[model samples]
Target: MSALATVHVVVPARNEERLIGRCLDALATSRALLLAERPTLAVRVTVVLDGCVDGTAAVVRRAPGVDAVHVTELSAGGARAAGVARARDLEPDLDRGRTWVACTDADSVVPAEWLVGQVLAAEQGAVCRVGAVHPELGPAERLLHLGWLARHSHAEGHPHVYGANLGFSLAAYEHVGGFAPLACGEDVDLVQRIRAAGLAVVSTGDDPVRTSARRSSRVRGGFADYLTALAVDLARAT
Candidate 1:
């Protein structure tokens, strides 16, 4: 096999000036770690900037082991779709069987073993893998999320979907017509589509991504807004 596998990472960032560096650093480290273990495994990262007005692009441009792509009017889904295409184009052959497309948000930091874990799963026959996203919350926010967790317990084979920490085979992705253009819930939409096509989309709890807990989210009614609304409701109940 050519280099065991080739993994491409895609990150969608709008104005993540504060968090892009950390995110990129973590990803760069993960790539190095994976290469160290499996020297033949190829890896590439693309940071897709969507109409950013801050230093997100600047940070990514200087970052090692990553490519930057700027777009005028792209959100979460469109940005990632654009990134996927760009990343694949960089590869010499773009072997569909050995190629993997992974995604994480610019506001999140993946673990050092993030990419390695995904590659392991893929090597063991996992077509799609979705990792968990833990918000960097404070004491109050943690307690608030506790109630939300009661109903959303992490169990084996849980269908929790998040674009910030998900990956799929190249062939499977193109087969699904690529990612849809949605402001939010694009991750879930893509997962559902993959499953509907009779593909295996499973969850892996190891080395879950750490995301921001800011109430003012990039996408309205997203994870951040969900936490804000929950906090409001809980405070009212108390």
Candidate 2:
């Protein structure tokens, strides 16, 4: 049907064999919610393995409803660009104007309603949809991350979407040049560009995406250290 809208989910994975499966599983669950709420919404998941040495491609193929794309060079931004391009090419009939794209890291697990929520926002005329990234941690670690979230959550002023849970219309994505070929901070940079171009970025905290807190643990710096690292990199842009 011409009236049907399409939404593609792209995940850039690098050495995430252990967690990519969970992310794909969450996407399958998201597909269910989208189908129930927006029957006219077509859904597809593209998992881009960013030069992973592990069995990331195998894991994605095994996932119930994922189309895996293995990118030989391991660059997050580059992988995302390739993935989005592949999505558009694979589904030639997709309406670039009405089609929406959702991006998340392979290490993150989206909520069941993630896609549905983003679609709803897009339908409401939101050009850029930003969702919260909650830490998937043990009780103590979660408490620490929560405290960090509370303290830094107010940083949500404009174009402050995390790559872990971001969505935009195909038109909007292309308008922002998709993901740039940068080594880091491409997400923050892209969102900032979106805002600079006068597009609205709506944050939907209700739809939380779960991400590992291992980076924080590895820092021995804990949540503060992790936040400091990202903040040092993204604070100016945010």
Candidate 3:
């Protein structure tokens, strides 16, 4: 028999004032839904304001369900690492075997079942749950997003890394020494290490996160760049 574990969510943001409100709203809704399903489950959220010179902090501060809000100058990987540390510090009694760490972006909206799905995966012996992400975009970006989806679906193999929507048990995360301090590719790096260590990494295919499709993003080389590249390729093909 497996025991229910606490869920610690980390969101690292940089100048995401415009999207932070929506992100928090979606997360609060998801938390409510998760609590309804498992009244006794413990879920906490930490929003790290990475170099945010905007109202992102205020938004998180007023959010009803968030557990912590940290301000820092780091972006991408550094910000994420800080957020995870905040979660760890806030819960000093957290047991690696029973607690799970979940991560999402400031510009993304997750479904109500996001935490529930991750907890269930952990309880079932999965060390990590790599989830899917859908793009929220305009018409042009939507076309590119769909194209990417189709291309990925028919690609040679499935993706092994996705930071926007990812989760892992604390034990596995600690074993890999957590996210590195790079500005990009932290998600890929962490997952590669976990896989290299022979941890049980599974797919949370059903709960795809809704992430922004804007070309301008916090991370320099990320999904935004991929979409922009696809758009460029599309223009060249025309």
The full ranking of all candidates by lDDT, starting with the best, is 1, 3, 2
Model 3 stretches with alpha carbons more than 4 Å out? 154-157
lDDT tens per residue, model 3, 1-238: 1575677889988878889788888888888888898888788888887767888778888888786556667747778888888766887887778878889998899998888788788878889888888778666466676677776552223574678889988888889999998878999999999999999888656678888878875567877888888888876876
Residue lDDT tens for model 2, 91-200: 88777887888998877899888888888788777888877777665765544555556554633443245778888878878887888876666677777788789886
Q: Model 3: how far is 23 from its true place, Å?
A: 1.1
**Backbone atom clashes (below 3 Å) for every candidate:** 0, 0, 0
Q: Which candidate leads the pack in TM-score?
A: 1
Instruction: Pull out the clashing pairs in model 1.
Output: none
- Residue runs of model 2 more than 4 Å from their true location after superposition: 1-4, 154-159, 216-238
Candidate 1 Cα outliers beyond 4 Å, as residue runs: 1-4
lDDT per residue for candidate 1 within 111-195, as digits (tens), equals 9999988888787777789888887877756677676676455565877888898999888888898889888888898888889
Error of 1 at 87 (Å): 1.9
CA lDDT, every model vs. true structure = 0.84, 0.76, 0.80
| Best candidate, lDDT | 1
User: Using Cα atoms with residue i matched to residue i, what is each candidate's TM-score against the true structure?
Assistant: 0.94, 0.85, 0.92
